[model samples]
Target: MENKDKTDWRFKVANREALIGCGLALLNFVWWFGFAYGMGSRPVEEYSYILGMPDWFFYSCVVGFLLITALVIFVVKVFFKEVPFEEEEELR
Candidate 1:
C-alpha cells in the first residue's frame, strides 16, 4: 500500500499571483508613460497656475500621483485579494 500526500493547489495559486502582479505592473507602466509624455509635451509658458504658482508646480502632482499609484498596486497585491485555489489557506 502506498500513502500519497496531495498538494497540487499551490501551483494554481502561484500562477494566479503572478498574473495579478503582471497585470498591475503593466498598468503602472502605462500610467507613468502617459504622465511623462504629457508633461514632456507641455509648454513651459502654459503651465497651470494655482495661487499664482507656475504651472510646472502641477508636475509635482504627477510625482504624488505616481507614488499613490504604486501604493495602490502594492496594497492590492498585499491585501484586498486572494487567488482562488482548492486549498483553504492563503499563500504567503
Candidate 2:
C-alpha cells in the first residue's frame, strides 16, 4: 500500500499556482502602497493631476488595477496548467 496523495502530480501543480498567485498579489499591493504613500505624502495644494485625476490615485488605483489585471491574465495563460479534478485509477 503506497500513499497516492504524496505522489500526486496535481498537488505540485496546485502549489506552484498558489505561490504564483500570492506573489502576484503581493506585487500588486507593493505597487499600490509605494505609489499611494510616496506620491500622496505631499500637501493637497502641491498635488498634481493627470487626465483629470490626482497623480497618486491615477497611478495607484487605476493604473495598478489595469496592470495587475493584465499580469494575472498573462500568468494564467503562461504559467498555470489545467489539472483534471477527477480521480484517476491506478493501472495494475
Candidate 3:
C-alpha cells in the first residue's frame, strides 16, 4: 500500500478548473442580473425592442446565453486538460 502526495498534479489541475468554472458562473450571473434589472427597471412605454423582443430580454437572456456558451466551449477546449483516472502501479 502507498500514500499519494497531497500536491499531485491531478489535484492542482482539478482545483484550477473548478475555480475557472466558478468564475464563469459568476460572470454569467452578473451579466444576466445587470441587463435584466438595469434596462428592465425603466417604464414599459420607454422600453426598446429588438427582433420583436424587449431589448433587455434579448441582451440579457439570448445574447448572454450565446456568449456564455461560446466562452465555456472555448475555455474547456483550450484551458482544460484530460487527466487519467487509473492508479499507477509501483515499480519493483
Candidate 4:
C-alpha cells in the first residue's frame, strides 16, 4: 500500500511553516520600509534634533527600528510554533 502521508499534497507541515515565516518576514520588511520612507520624506529641520541627528533619523530610523525589531522578536517568540522537519526518503 502507498504511504498516504508521503503522497498527500493537499497540505504539508513544511509548506505551512514556510508560509507563516514568509508572511512574518514580509510584514517586517513593509513596516521598516514605511518607517524609513515616511519619516525620511518630511521637511528638514522641522523638529528638534537629538544628539546632533535629525529628529527623523533619531526617532524613525534609530528608535523606530529598535521598536520594530523588538516587536518582531516578540511576535515570533509568542506566535510561531516549532514544527519538526520531515525526513525525506533516500532514492534506491
TM-score for each of the candidates:
0.49, 0.92, 0.89, 0.53
Local accuracy of candidate 1 as per-residue lDDT tens digits, 1-92: 43245445566567776787777667667666665566646787766665675444444455547775787767676745455646476356
Kindly indicate the candidate among 2 and 4 with the higher lDDT. Answer: 2
| 60: Cα error in model 3, Å | 0.4
State the lDDT of candidate 2 residue by residue for 24-86, as single tens digits: 999999999999999999999999999999999999999999999999999999999999999
User: 1-92, model 4: which lDDT tens digit per residue?
Assistant: 98886664435755765787787677667766775677767777565578998765676568867876786688678765665457566588
- Stretch of 10 with least lDDT, candidate 2: 1-10
Candidate 2 overall lDDT versus native:
0.96
Candidates 1 and 2 compared: the better one by lDDT is 2
Root-mean-square deviation of every model = 7.5, 1.8, 2.1, 4.9
Count clashes in each candidate, considering only residues at least 3 apart in sequence or on different chains.
2, 0, 0, 0
> Model 2 segments beyond 4 Å from truth?
1-6
Query: What is the Cα root-mean-square deviation between model 4 and the actual structure?
Result: 4.9
Ordered from best to worst lDDT, the candidate numbers read 2, 3, 4, 1
User: In terms of TM-score, which candidate is stronger, 1 or 4?
Assistant: 4
Model 2 has a clash total of 0
